[model samples]
Target: MTAASSEAVAGAVSPLGRAGRGPHFRRREKAWGYAFVAPALLLFAVMGVYTIAYGFTLSFARWNGFSPRWIWVGLENYIDLLGGSPVYGPPVRAAALNTLWVMIAVPLLTVAVSFPLAVILNSVTRLRTVLRSVYFIPYVTNGIAIYFAWQYIYEPNGAINGVLGALGLGSLQQPQGFLGNPATALPALIVVMVWTAVPVAMLLYLAGLQAIDPALLEAAKIDGAGWWRTNRSVVWPLLTGTTAIVVLLNLRDALQGFQVFLIATNGGPGDATNVLGLETYRLAFLSELAPTLGLASALGWMLFLVALVIALVNQRMLRRLR
Candidate 1:
């Protein structure tokens, strides 16, 4: 080939040369990327991968937290939990159901309450920042503090009952106390869960609302669409991503949330408020209860599996919606 033709052929074969980099530079870039990610990978290996593996292994063995001897039970604990062993099986099933109830109720309630508030906040031109801050205070506040406050409010002679009594609706007052009655305890706890969850959901929705094109809403208005029609037709469709996020977060929280129940009800009034998370804690740590670390680990795995399934389902539903 001629010199000109040789040069053109070499250029055609070597795109990286034209870009001022080659295989060596690319290798170095990759090395730097790995170097940057090394710490995070190490942390995940130690904290996530190793722990998960160990926990799963532990679930098949009997061990108190400090015991060096781990007796291999080989599905005995699983049988006790699932194979109709009356002692452990009933509480486990009940707690699982309660957790499911909370997971369903809290997220739906949070979204239903937060969405309209977010819409209003998005439309406001005055004191919007202040109102948002006020709403978000509960999210940032200490959870235990909120639990105690709500506990007082649910007391028989507390502010809620006081107000009802003064309104001459004395019969409406919960003399047994909201948390003291089995019929009301779980629902009351759900109310508190919804209350704490709404602020975060509201913030997420506000962001989603702001990201929407204002011109679309204006066009809808020009087409003689009212508030409900505009939101139902335009806003709701656009906020699907935000809704998915909100639902996942709320579901995870409700499934794993134990602290609120620990402080507020302690799964009291005849296991009325019992849930898997709290039950796990009880089995693992509470001295008054049986220290069944293996059982607790099993429960933890069960919870993890349930959460994983729900997340996958949520993703699939979101994909279908899109």
Candidate 2:
């Protein structure tokens, strides 16, 4: 046989088979696969790559995002953000603190609230799919619609206030928006965030629960363990890795919670709810606060770093569980 025929024979050992067709057909298959994937890769690079490069470039300059050009000033944005410039100092510090709070509280709250619901959902018999869909509806709803509904519900003379008034608890009036109260605003957004996120976590946990062998639960029962004891001793121990994954995913989701807060409170009633996401947004786009593109890029990269670290730690813990 010719050199080409011999090469075709070797390549045809693949599952696709047949030396006669191997070289041309295999290359054709690969070409088609690449063609099919090209659009997605192109879209990903266009949407993600440009922004990342631009943001990084901006972080090293004073480009308020509007002006035609930027003047490079290396690390000035970082310095200004970290309290070097008195103008940008205080808000940056406060925004960092707020970001930290949301990061901690929102994920923890979602895990705590959703895990039990997941357990219950897994246990359901009748109307299981219907019930799961009901719980998941809020997650799929338009966020804008939810924000408006919440605005009405939290209004002084709205449902919440009306209920409080009828119960002789006085009206739940704050005069200013719920976003107005420094003490309550951040925590309030945390609640909305956790609530919206719980359904997804619940679904994930339920999938994990189903993968767990029923025989394990049965064995625990035969050992004279009650329901709670079986869950604690048998169910939960096996669920550690799942829980860790859930936490990691939830943390990633919570980290990007700017839009939820923006829609609900617009990061306002005076910056009470202004986390790093909102702060970066305002710096990058809002107002004429001397667009510190470099600082904004730094903020973007900081978010990326925080997310990366948490994800890495999560992977480590998951491996240890195995």
Candidate 3:
């Protein structure tokens, strides 16, 4: 009935105290935790794990997608693509090469453009929200619509050419069409890819910039560091984490780039813009080509492996940066 006795009773009844006393309380908590997570676990098993397993199985078998029958081809599909078969090897190599090119170009260009824009926007005091929204418009806009708009812009007599002509640089015009020329097609697509990708990276960089301590910048300035020098010395080092995230996301997106190429070039001009994702689509769906679902699945798995490796490497770099 005294305060100490009451406190002792309360402590004995408390779950945390009980857990400290014996293992039963902890076991019950673990059971409840699993019960709470069961639905999500089930959903992941069905949607993620099962699908991955099924795809892996399908990769070794030829299926028309409609027929119940799947011809067990084992590693023939992989061999055809990897062993440089006369039919499928060239396109796969070309597509893989292009995907690698994009994986290199898009991320670097996106970061280069976005970081400066983010720095400028972060320094602005007027209409910052409006400016950010304007920059993010392309990311939220309809992809097909943007591709169509960009197609027109890259046309022979389109806005870009018109601007060039008006600038008295009509000689620089690509009358054959930017998308039609093999030399310019991938670069043009890279430009559009960079445009759509920049806003996301810019937002990330802006967040990183805002998270930086004001004292650091002040200290740098007090030490006679100007705008550029302060950023180089203080701000850049602090942003390594954000930069890693931006690079990883951009790299993954570039490696799997499909919709833009699909809508814009369809990997044309003699496969100049073909990439792994588009190649998978062509193999799986195009009626003119042999419907090699197994081959397509092989390419998909290869892409998945490459992405996984790159992600792991980036994660290591991120840790080192930290």
Candidate 4:
């Protein structure tokens, strides 16, 4: 065969030359299909994967976030963080306490408020939609704007204290408006966080309530169960999934409570309200004023690991609930 004839002969036996695909050819096509996802894989690696790896790598370094002074210090940063660096820095113990307090307060307050509201909303007939919207208004409201507005209300002579004075509840001239008082500091943030969370959790419970079969409720009533008994025996069991989801979601958000912490306290009134998230941000970026980048990075990874562990526990609880 000549060159052109030889080429034509190979083409004739090639996959393209075949009329139909066999198993081997289909497997090869599927193998090539995986190549189409390569761009997404590459994008994720660069955007997400690389940044995480680089951040953790920076934790051991003794450099500012910028500049080329990135010298590795072996486990020094971790040692100082774990073992306590009395002379050079504040120990991480205080931040950990603040975080624990916020975490507990947020979830407890959220569940306490939202669950009752959800139950009442479920029981009532008229204006349910309006009530839900009213409750949910804060969730859609801008947190930054709310904080600034609330910040004023929290000021010494602001409207809240004014209300207290008008009601003869004692003037807040001693100047404690949920923001400054050491007692109220963490609880105030927890209250705002809980207020924002309720609408969402109430909505979840409402969904669960709606999902309940009306026929079952009626059957329970006919079988001599009162409304309260019917709800406990029939409705409550059905709502377990949504309850689990709401509790876990609320817990997760509360544990990660940064926005409220940052806005409400700025970790203030003498570090009385410092959650781990705020501490991490302050150390890493805020400390850029003095620039303790390595310390900040170490703090950040610590917070990340804590959050990851909480998330895992949340997921495990959710699974176990099923």
In order, candidate lDDTs are: 0.90, 0.80, 0.90, 0.76
The number of the candidate with the highest lDDT is 1
Per-residue lDDT tens digits for candidate 4, residues 196-275, read 78889888878888887889988998999997798778887777777767766776675555887787778888888887
Model 3 CA deviation exceeding 4 Å by range: 1-43
Write candidate 3's Cα lDDT for 127-188 as tens digits: 99999999999999998999999999999989999999999999888997899899999999
Could you tell me which 10 consecutive residues in candidate 2 have the lowest summed lDDT?
A: 171-180
Cα lDDT tens digits for candidate 2, 253-278: 67755887778787777788888888
TM-score of every prediction relative to native: 0.85, 0.84, 0.87, 0.81
Name the best candidate (by TM-score).
3
RMSD in Å for model 1 = 5.2
Query: What is the C-alpha local distance difference test score of candidate 3?
Result: 0.90
- TM-score between model 1 and native: 0.85
Question: Tens digit of lDDT per residue, candidate 1, span 1-322?
Answer: 8998987777768865544376777888899999999999999999999999999998998888777789999888888878557878888889988998998899999999999999999999999999999999989999999999999999987888899989999987899898998999999999999999999999999999999989999999999999999999999989988999999999999999899899998899889999999989988887354448998898898889989998999999888988
Q: Rank the candidates by TM-score, best first.
A: 3, 1, 2, 4
Q: Give the TM-score of candidate 3.
A: 0.87
Q: lDDT ranking from best to worst?
A: 1, 3, 2, 4
Please say which candidate is ahead in lDDT: 2 or 3: 3
